[model samples]
Target chain A: MTLSADGSRAGRSPRRGLSMRAGRRLWLAIFLAPAVVLFAAFVTYPILSALAYSLYSWEGIGRSGFAGVGNFIRLFTTFPYPRLLANAFGNNVIVFVLTMLVQNLTGLGLALLLARNPWGARAYRAIFFLPVTLSLVIVGFLWALFLNPVFGVVNKTLGIVGLGALARPWLGEPGIALVTLTLINAWRWLGFPTIVFLAGINAVPEDYLEAARLDGASEWDVTRRIIFPLLAPAVTIIVILTFIGSFNWFELPYVVQGVSGAPNRATDVLGLLFYRTAFGEVDTGLQDIGVGSAIAVLMFIMLVTVSTVGAVFLRRREVEMG
Target chain B: MRRLCTAMIAVALLATFFPASVLGQEPAKLSFWSWRTEDKWVYDRMIRLFQQRNPGIKIEFIPFRAPEYATILSTGLTAGRGPDIIHLRAYGGLETFAAPGFIAPLDFEQVPELKRFPLQTIAGARSRKDGRIYGVPFATQTLVIFYNKKIFAQHNLTVPKTWEQFITVMRTLKDKGVVPLANGGKEGWTLEVLSGVIAPNFYGGTTFFEAVTRGQTTFRESAYTGALAKMLELRPYMPTGFMGVDYATMQQMFINEQAAMFIGGSWEIGFFKAQNKNLDFGVFPGPTERADQIPWVSSYADGNYGINAKTANMEAALKFIRFTATLEFGQMFTDLLAQMSAVPGVVVKNPQLQQVQAMNRKATPYIMLVGFRWQAPTGSTLLQSALQGMMAGTLTPAQVGEEVTRGLSSWVDAFRGR
Candidate 1:
């Protein structure tokens, strides 16, 4: 027997290597098949189809003909569409900004409080996270009733507190409707970030605090300079997820304000616009799937670009802190 | 075990190949779909009546939410997997289905009762492109002011006959701390209906509608803007914080007797009675600008029943749709639904429904729906938003006119010249 490379016999080496390669190939295929198939079917296929559909004029489900960039042009130049598209995009930006601000501050504050392991800390955590578990439909519908001008509990509570002067229609005013919707959305999702931040705080090593204390650092100083920086990963996740959620928001607003985002389109969002365009308005009963697809493609590009850039920036910060 | 499995497979294959006719046991079932979920019980009663007359066919009535119905129906029809019979919306709503041949076309020969309906009424179910009637016209909804009889009696206010008297009545109601109008700005469609009740009286009704359609005038004309201005004049008499009030709330206000009047469709009669058995209300044509002016209400054909083009049970579907066109179905609809039936010669026994029919005689087409719903940037959409802005104090009446004119001008050649 002749040794090959190391101590293996030359005759046996070729057969063993060949079988090992074949076995590894089979195992790789087995492991990757489901994920690859799913990604192609759900992700790649939809994106490509939407891109293709955007370039054509569609009458309901039937493709009328290729229109090149006609659909996109219509979105930008059409009398009401340009106005609607801008309003929706601007509302999404507002939703993202307000949601991020409200979630982070409240979440971080709650996390810090719970980090002390106060009496019934687990119960408090459960209470804070409870809203996240409720169905968005129920939450939206309940909130709509609560905010009603005459019968709503919100206005009733204000009356009881003698703040009756401030009891205006929360969702009826065009100026404040989008803001009201965002705050409701924030209330629904506040629990998720609070739990994430709490976990991050708990994972902080106790020895670091002890060392900081030994050096005569105040609790506030230790938290500001130490624990805060260590929670970077959690913040990154919460921020990115909130951004995506805000842009893709549909159900809660749809349930509360409807597809028109009533009160003169005050609460219109990209998602609602997409749906109205695709399915036709309840009153007019005319649908333009080509324009709807165009809106979808634009939204997708925006989401992907912003999210990727944000993740890279956040991940870099995480690495720096680590 | 292998022999048992083989035997089971053989039985299943044989069952699939055996026709119901061969078995001479089961009736042929035809599925029906509609957006009138609220009317499902009534439809079930109607379907039972049809089943009694025709024992060999069983019909299934399925209803979906109004907002989701169009999408659901389109998706099902596209996949060649929808119901055999369909309840379709009229005008542009019917055209979307009919233009693509998703609905089977009907002829006067197939259903001779189609000749009973006037051309204008039949136009609602006719395909704009193909010029073929595709469905049986079902009902007509007229816009009118519904007044709480008790409140009007308490205030000694008979229905006003002119614009000046109407304002005086509203003012009196406001002074008495009653919401004069139960309408709101929260829902654009409700606002459109509110406009429909008030606008035509100022804009010369069918005459102006014809002129605009013929490209002789546009929405920017004073007659149209003046009508919008009239709507603004009633802002003070509307419910408190009316901008936040929705259709349900508006209905609640009227039903609860918090508001004295409601501008809504005639279809509200059934809903009002159902919600509040003790409620007493009466309908009136919207007051005119002058005592002599025609009190023109906006009216349109509401919906229709059609056969799905790809139905396997075509014979049964046609039979049922024909039943819908008969005077019997029309009377049942008018009595149960409390709206005007499109079927001619059907006596409306209900007093409230009779009043709606009387008011509809002076009706102009619900202009936006009849003339402008065929294309994108629809006139209804433009008018709704404009009216909302006007109510919100963001836009003046002329601006509302201009906005609507601008939107319609994009597709309407009549407005394009200016």
Candidate 2:
């Protein structure tokens, strides 16, 4: 029973089936060597040590010499580092276009009002996913003490409902501090795009929404012409995770604006200028680490070339709207 | 009993992995560290009174998190591992660990009370590229103002020495409704400590900090843009959206009296008498444009006590950093941290720390943390983001003195090629 005499002499000699296809290619390189050595020790060794510490000139942690690209030509010709890198890349493109228009129109109007399962729809989907389970340092320290422009309870409930001339200083206005931190990061990621658009509206095909509601259609034309074009793979997984969480925003504007993104820096971003240039912040006095490894290698080549060209142009609009 | 519970779990894993070689000759412990996480219960009661005056030593302490304690103490002393007494910071945060040797210089024979401090508070722990003295100088602070005194004795008011009687006593305590500047601007270093308490009486203090650290005259001079236009003329006596008032809501609007004055820093007098034990308050120092000028204040040197040059208990961390420069640990660190103790004679016994040690004898150098915080665009981070863009009007006290002489001419050889 030697494996049926070596599987009938390895199907009549193809050099004994090339040693059984080199013993199944050495068990597929020993089952892909520990996820390719843990993705090259935690993602290609910290992006090639932040591209070799963005060409030298360190200081605190010492490296001192080489400065070839000279900290990316002083982070784009210095003077407040090119106006704080174009005001932190224009506040990360206004926190990714106002957190993608306030989290896709309030996450597709709360997934079309919680896909009709009215009253306690699983306790209103765990109370709209309870601020994505709290801790962004307790939602930026309870929204910087409930937007404290004087003992805050939101300007004393807009001065007890009279609206007190629209209580302003909501984050000390520098043209409304990055739209009040993109509406508090779309109120803490609008329940992750309302549970991915209520599982893309309960997987849409109820006989193609009852043949477009027996052809009478209009529930806003079966929600804007067929469940918003079949919720194109949950809007391309929330537009490539809101373009990599709006350029990795950094701990709720560093726990409600402190790393110098205050009133003037108007909610600065490139993750609080790469954590005040690689962690120096006693109100940004020292740490350079060669311009924080050239702002972490220009934010990893702008979030991998705009989220891989917006995830291949939104996966070709989810295969031409599936 | 199951072989005596496996021989007492191998002598409790050999005393939890050789805690100093399982006590054969224990006591050299050391460690320390600090950032003051609220002075760890007065440094664990001053390390148990320096471990009962050094009975074969044993310290420990630790602390941290004061804004991630200078990047976790320079990444734990650049990974050579840390603590054997450290707590540094004064002057360019102690020349970022005494110009990289990671501290350990001191002299007068291993810190003989760094010869009783004051050479400008031991030049804030020295080391400007090896001038030496690594660390010891501990508390100084100053700044000034404070006020309240039961809202200036129920608004009868007085102290205003000059700046037009301090803008008519903050316009009669802002027409009596009060909040006469509990200072704010959502903490860009408390608007650089309110431009070091109103820019050293319109930037002429110590003759503009020795002509702006000898590059002859810089912060775009008109006496430092008339002290950033007297901090935008104390922006309508402060509080109302004082740029979204922060430093813990400007110390909870001056310990809840709803703000009568504040300015800040004599380490907020033991956190306003431990947050209001009948909060009266007093202090002063800022107003001078004329009542015979000598006002000044703006002090500095608020840190030190170093050692760790990879300290394997260097003689119990130099006898616990020379018992933190003596005078009985500077009168128990100015009677438990009300502060001022850069240790000279140390006999304040707190009458408001003896008027902050007599207005720190007309002090001066808080100018961007003493001579432009050493390097890379610092001058206290370009005057705390140009005084938070001149208190958010989006800048102009001559553009916060031309944005702090163009970020200290990118590295101050007296504002280089300005």
Candidate 3:
């Protein structure tokens, strides 16, 4: 009787334990179900479908014939393919560098200046951030109009200032077009970063600044060592966001230059090229869908890779101030 | 889990219920998509008239802007939710849509007035390989030289009939501190007309269109090279910051009397007139050196309406198209929009259009260069880019030609591979 009782106790304990575990798992699954399903439907399915599409000669309509790696092969050899890729990558890198250097530097400087509670600081913030809130399309069109050589305010003002020689076509010359576009891009985005950096600057305890000032530290030194270090998180966020935005850039160039990326194809970016390849233009017939898909896949891979690298490297520099 | 289940049930129920009556309907509502917002008044009137004429048929008008139209159309077709009829601008990529069976072939016998339209217009609408009519003939437009009469009178110059005279007149205007040509090299189409059409037609005589269409002659050997050379020669006479100006800005220069002459299509007449009704302007054929060869005129159907393959109301869609083709609708629509009709009996009263009509009539023997008439997709961009490059000084005339050849050949190979 004692042996049977022991055996029954052991069996009941394990069985009860198993049932409890099962119940816990069910609860966990129930909690996670919505997110998993949403992610699967939105992200995973589209990516897998894109991958499948990358192997076929589909025109985004009707029966898509299978073409395997032929599309990828054609992308390298086709008309201006190599040049197009180079132009896109080079332009993107240049824009990214320029934005990081100019936009961030200018933004940080502005934040520092504004942190001093300069006159009309509130009005200044509103004016500076206004462009950021406007649509990129509207900004592009507005800039295109403003930069018009004949009647544009820029050239007209330059002429009025007796600097007519310096007022050349901003968006037309190949050497200057990308630089001009980058500057415009920086101008548009600077406000967002400036606001964030200003918030970061404000968050720095006033006592620390006062202590540094009392310790005979110059304003530059305080900014460089204390405030700047603390503002690293905002800087990192801005950099990552900027990197992704630059890599995925399309609308501005598209609206400004149209489909040909004209003025000698100076403004052709990867997004525009991908679209042209996929949709075909007046001159080029429809590009092989497989090849276009491959280009898209490459673009996706590039954006993901760059973003990941940027996030990891920049996040490491983010100082968690105790 | 419960939320997900509820959402799924809702989606399933909606999907099932929405499509049931749609599937059961006969003479279903046919949706016609167009990128003609500027002419919405005329289109709406026509649609109403069509509906009044055919009470059994229901038509839905889906209008989008030009840029968004292509994306929307492609998306809708791919998703199996495409409209019954679609308006397609004449461009090179039509074959891609036709090849995939996303476009349906039109039976011309149903609308026999197809014979009255220009053969080139019909040719552009037909699939090159299968010879199937996929689009209804609509309106035709051509590039014409638009010169400001006030500027011309100021410079004491008349509309030049010869290429040499045109250059001479332009030089004279330039000497007077007036910009000769209102051109935006930033917009590649202006560059295309300057290099691809004007240059080649004048220098190569009748062989320009032949060489391009046949794909045997390189752009280098054609008069197109001469055109580029001429453009280079005339570059000094153009307005400062010519490269920076866009189509609208350039047109505004001409309209505002900042520039003397503007080369553009007939489509701009209405816009220009609307902007400045009193601006004295005259239209003339693009100048040519060889008067005997007949001034080669370029004209093509601007846009055509086609029935979607997935249309639920094919008969109703055809009825709408037939109604749209009638003389009453065609004339009224074309007149209000200031466009030359594809329908034979529709008369356009605008003097500029009358000049274009006369030119089209006179140049009937000369081959009309329909830039849209290409079976391959890459030819248009190739032409545009090559011309643009030449105009921008990045590419020489010979190099531009080579690029066109290379682009076309590569496109051919790509299409064949597909």
lDDT of 3: 0.74
Scored by DockQ, the top model is 1
Model 1 lDDT at residue B215:
83
Better of 1 and 2 by DockQ: 1
For all candidates in order, state the fraction of native interface contacts they contain.
0.49, 0.54, 0.55
Q: How accurate is candidate 1 locally (lDDT)?
A: 0.88
The i-RMS of every model, in angstroms, reads: 1.6, 8.6, 3.3
Number of the candidate with higher lDDT, 1 or 3: 1
A1-322, model 1: which lDDT tens digit per residue? 2466766477687788788889999999999999999999999999999999899987645677899999999899977789899999998999898988887788899999999999999999999999999999999989988988867888789889999888877888888888889889888888899999999988888988899999999999989988988989999999899889999888888999888877778898999999888778885747778999999999999999999999999988873433
Q: Could you give candidate 2's per-residue lDDT for residues B1-418 as a string of tens digits?
A: 9999999999999777777645657777778888778878988887898899887888878887788888887878888788888888877778877787878887898777788677988887886787888888878888888888888889898899888898898899899888798888877888888778877888778887897798887888887788778778888998777887788888988988898888878888898889888988889888888887678888978878888887877888888888878888888888988787888888887788798788878888888777887766687776777677777787788887888788778778667677
Best by lDDT: 1
The per-residue C-alpha lDDT of model 3 at residue B351 equals 84
> TM-scores, in order shown?
0.95, 0.36, 0.87
Write down the DockQ of candidate 1: 0.58
Clashing pairs in 2: none
DockQ, candidate 2, comes to: 0.19
On TM-score, the leading prediction is 1
Tell me the deviation in Å of residue A161 in model 1: 2.5
Q: What are the chain A TM-scores for all the models, listed individually? A: 0.93, 0.39, 0.84
Worst 10 residues of 1 chain A by lDDT: A1-10
